[model samples]
Target chain A: MRRRSFFQVAGATVAASTLVLAGCKDTEVVQPTTTNVLNLGSNDAGVLNYAYLLEQLEAAFYQKVLDTPPADMPKEELALFTELRDHEVIHREYLKELLGANAIPTVEFDFTSLTLTTRAGVLAAARTFEDLGVAAYNGAGKLFTSKAFLVAAGKIASVEARHAAFIHDLAQAPAFTGVVETSGRYTGMATALTPLQVIEAAVKFFPFTVITSGLPTA
Target chain B: MNLFKIIAELEKVDPEVMDRLSHRRSALSALGDFSKKMALAAAPIAVGSAFNKAMGQNTLTDANGILNYALLLERLEYSFYDQALKAATLTGTLTGAARTAIETIRAHELAHVNLLTAALGSNAAPAPANGFDFGSAFATYPGFLTVAQALEDTGVRAYKGQAGNIPRTLNPTVGGAVVNLLTVALQIHSVEARHAAHIRYMRRGATAGAQSTIFPWINNADANGAPAVVYGAGNPVATFPAESNLAQGGISNLATGLGTTYTVEDVSAAFDEGLDNTTVTAIARATATF
Candidate 1:
């Protein structure tokens, strides 16, 4: 009789737990922008999409610069802007292909906070994006499960670093070199920022919410 | 009471149950359970290895290949700058700014060599003791700059090519160490890139009318007025072709509907290429000094 009572109680508990688990699973299907979060998914998909978003932001910024270049910007500078625009566009499209259905939709950016009609303004903006891009790659490379994708990210990163160095040099010949230095002597190291840190820096440029909740922590 | 005896008895009773699992899957499942139990028991050895990896401990067979290659590159770079600085060649041929830049580059390369050597310890390959011909590499100011540009650019590509291998070979049991190694490699890679741009900028300063033809970025071995001799025989002999490549990951920069007005050269300049092991090894071998 005691064993029968125990069995009945155990069965009831199991049924109740199942219903609770089902309810919890239902809540896990994150709604988009409803509670102000843009789920970036998990693992490599999340990292790639994060990269894609950054590329999109950069591509849009360069496009804007080319669309209405600064008045005092030299023809040489304008040519550079044109090249940068194309590079970012290529990067954005390639990342899009890599992400396929996993990628986030087009993100609307707001660069209105910065003055875009001046060479200094444009270069400063370029500097921010390029440096941030390099750091993003550095911090996130290990999170990828694919070797090919990691190599691809590294290849793109060095190019972005080159862009950052050039733009920084163009703006202020030697000042840009100092930015990469954090300690005594030349470490030959660039900046590296985690996803959360990068998001913090990138948030101001973005008009919409960017949810990085599901992104890999390590 | 032996577990193997019990398993053998169970296998005899239910061969079909054991047969359902492939040998590899069964072993893996056993390992998974063991790890779970180990986790519950708070195994110190596993925790210690995790700590070691996080602290940048010497890798086993897996990641050591990449670390050794990086060590080789750092050694080559360190020797390159060491010779230039010791010879006082730059004082006569280059400006103070250029000299300062080279000094900064040398210091970084030395730091890199030290870091890699320490991380690799006994596993590290012996430093190149002899047999390199940089005489032509440093014969003239232009020659010196050309070689510097090539080495820096090569260093960037070599690191990029091997970066994927580091994480792939990293022991799954000690993931943090892999991240540590990658972080070190990337830090050096970006710095090398900046050095490449800095060298290009200095080279541009020497060009006629400072034409800005090179734009301080890689172009189809643009040579940007660095004489054809600069791409001479002894230099890496083979890996130069990929430096000018305009495509990445089988995707052409000129593919249709890309919607960009940038020319092929512009697109090529925007992306850097990764060099395979043989190519990087050859390049490193070509640069060593006796």
Candidate 2:
């Protein structure tokens, strides 16, 4: 659902409180940077805002997929993507709640380059996202200050790993299996990306000055 | 005099007041030689675990504690997987496919235990004489299922708990030892997931819903996963009386929180919270008599 539509619910009030800074008057809507960029403020909440921004982008992308699915998309693939979409939504909302009262402003994304019409394009993007998330967790694990935060990050990272594996499995075509299970097309390559690297790649994909300072400097 | 004799003579001298002349040089060199060998003897077995002390007290959870701890888990799984491989008693006659699948998983578990032990090197405590108390509770199917579920679940949590430490660079000799560790951890998690599913299936049907299931809370009655609890993403782990947690939580309601008096929700939350690999193994070891 669009942010505006999501805002219709009463839970949105509680959820909205988590997004904004304590006692802030201004709800400055930062327009999408280019067609795909988001701007995160500078703080701990900003880091979360950055993640939230990614989730928004991912959720939007998959929603688009569900709306206008691929011709070759089977029922199973369709179901999996649907599940992924719900997961992204849950992740997005979860972060929204976690960042309570300090959540950064909402941002937009640029997906103009991605060919959303085809199954191949969609799956490739999923691969990039999952890999990026894995690396992001690995790289950022050291950055989190709270021990609980690190543990939580770990839980998400494992899920990201599983997601990466799934995307990689789907990418396996023809007479090949995955390297972990068997030799396949994307066998040797990492479906993972480090946090700093993910940030850099994200910068290329989106137009946002992500200010990361308040998050744990573990 | 022979070296042994000279050493015996040297031992007779007062160590507190060594001779300060050139003649004393030989004794000092002898002591140095002995110290060097001492270092060599302990180096391979426990180098990484020891080097954790150099990490400057980030948290007391050091390499030695973690490495040996993981070794214990691998050993447990190794036993289970090995036994299951030969197990003719898998809900009656085992099909060839079932046997192969379980065996493949078994191989992976063995690899995990072996790899962990190797990492411990000489530091690894000697293997337990019999190894693992499967528990009299496991005498019945449900009892065994509960223990198996706990073990597989523990393995899942254990790997996750240590994933953070993987990239911490215990040995600078090889680049990205931590990354390798993370990879192994992920691999282990996947295999354990498969195992949990298998065990769960053997207990209830493969498609058993969360609704119809009846569970016994023999362990983790007080808490489902850990002391700290977080609902979903971006939330910090809630603190307990002792150590502050740092888990990056996502699933709000995975299992009900594992405490003495748990409801379905509590177990689900606990499952959701997940026990870190180190903590799970520690818990298992603490609970397991073996």
Candidate 3:
């Protein structure tokens, strides 16, 4: 009788736990309709989508600048900006293809905060985006489960860093120190921020909420 | 029944049983029930020791080796910049901006060396025995910039190549610390990229012997008179291709995929490549006298 009772209790426990798990999954699917949320998914997909989103924003910013370049922008600076636009576009398109069906939708960015009319203004905004992209890649590197994806991220991370350095130099020549930790255990290292932190900083640029809850923190 | 006898019998049925038991994550999951039962009877300290034993020791050794390799590289870089800065001949020709940039890079290298040393503790490899002799690199300002660019670019690639090798153990204590090394290496990798860009910028602006054609990013395997190996392929060309190679992630035709209007230089500059440890060490040895 004791053995039979034990089996019955075990069956009940399994059924109850299954229901709880299903309820938790349901809550995730039924988010409130008031705000649009961009879920970055999870695991490798999440990391790629997050990168795709940033590349989209960067590509858009450069494209806008190239469309209506600053009157005072030098010929050489304009050429450099054109290269920047092409690089970002390549990155955006490449990442989109990599994500395929898992890719996030095309995002329309809100660039009202940026001043794109003058050379200084444009370069400053580029610095901001480039620095953020570098930090995002650095932070996302350890989260990748696939070695190929990690290598891919590293390839792009350096390019982003190069872009950041050039923009920083052009915007504040002679004394521009690129985005690096000034004082700490990681003094020489570049800035690396979690997805939550990156999204928090980048939220102002996005029209919709970037839900990074599904992204890896470590 | 003896545990060994059972394990031996199980091995006949499944050859990979021992591998599964030794695998960090698998071992931890396998021990869950056993650990819980032990916790009810044994002390918490004993449980912690059991966890350590389950988490293999080889991971810690591998982590230390990577850290020491990085430490050696940083020390070499720091020494290179330190020697150049101390030389009046090179600094004499450098503009104020150029000098300041070198100073900034040197300070960062020093910080990296110190950070790695602290992380490695006793296992830290001693500084290179004879110190580096940069040879003619410091004889001229442009030469110094050339070598600087190569070293910075190499540093970026070396760190990227080792990223996957850094073990991600399951033991919370060791994993937490070792994983930080991966993060730190990545953070430093990008910083080296930034330094490489700035050095390339300086090279472009040189009044004499200027590599004006060279942009901040690598273009079509152009090493800018630094070694060709700096931009060449590693052991397995497929895994580590030349910087000019447009293929990425199995997509052979990036130009066609993106647009034909995107020139080869644009596509190539869009991404950087990593160098394997063997090639990187050979390059380092060539540059440094030690």
Pick by TM-score: which candidate is best? 3
True contacts kept of each: 0.36, 0.05, 0.50
* Error of model 3, residue B255, in angstroms: 1.4
Cα deviation in Å at residue A17, candidate 3? 37
Q: Which ten residues in a row have the lowest lDDT in candidate 3 chain B?
A: B1-10
lDDT per residue (tens digit) for residues B4-76 in model 3: 2222223332222322232233332323323233322222222222222321122223777778888888999
- Candidate 1 CAPRI-style tier: incorrect
Better of 1 and 3 by lDDT: 3
Per-residue lDDT of candidate 3, residues A1-218 (tens digit): 46345435654333323322232232122132345777887776788889989999999999999899999999888889889988999998877666655667887899999899998889888988999999999989888766567778889999999999888778765333547877855688889988888889888898888877777766
Ranking by DockQ: 3, 1, 2
DockQ, 0 to 1 scale, candidate 1: 0.20
Which candidate number would show the highest DockQ if scored against the true structure?
3
Candidate 3's C-alpha runs over 4 A off are: A1-35, A173-178, B1-61, B168-179, B208-210, B259-261
Classify candidate 2 by CAPRI docking class. incorrect
Candidate 2 positional error at A201, Å: 6.0
lDDT tens digits, residues B70-165, model 1? 887888888888788766655577657767778878877877777677677678888756734577666677768778877887788778666755
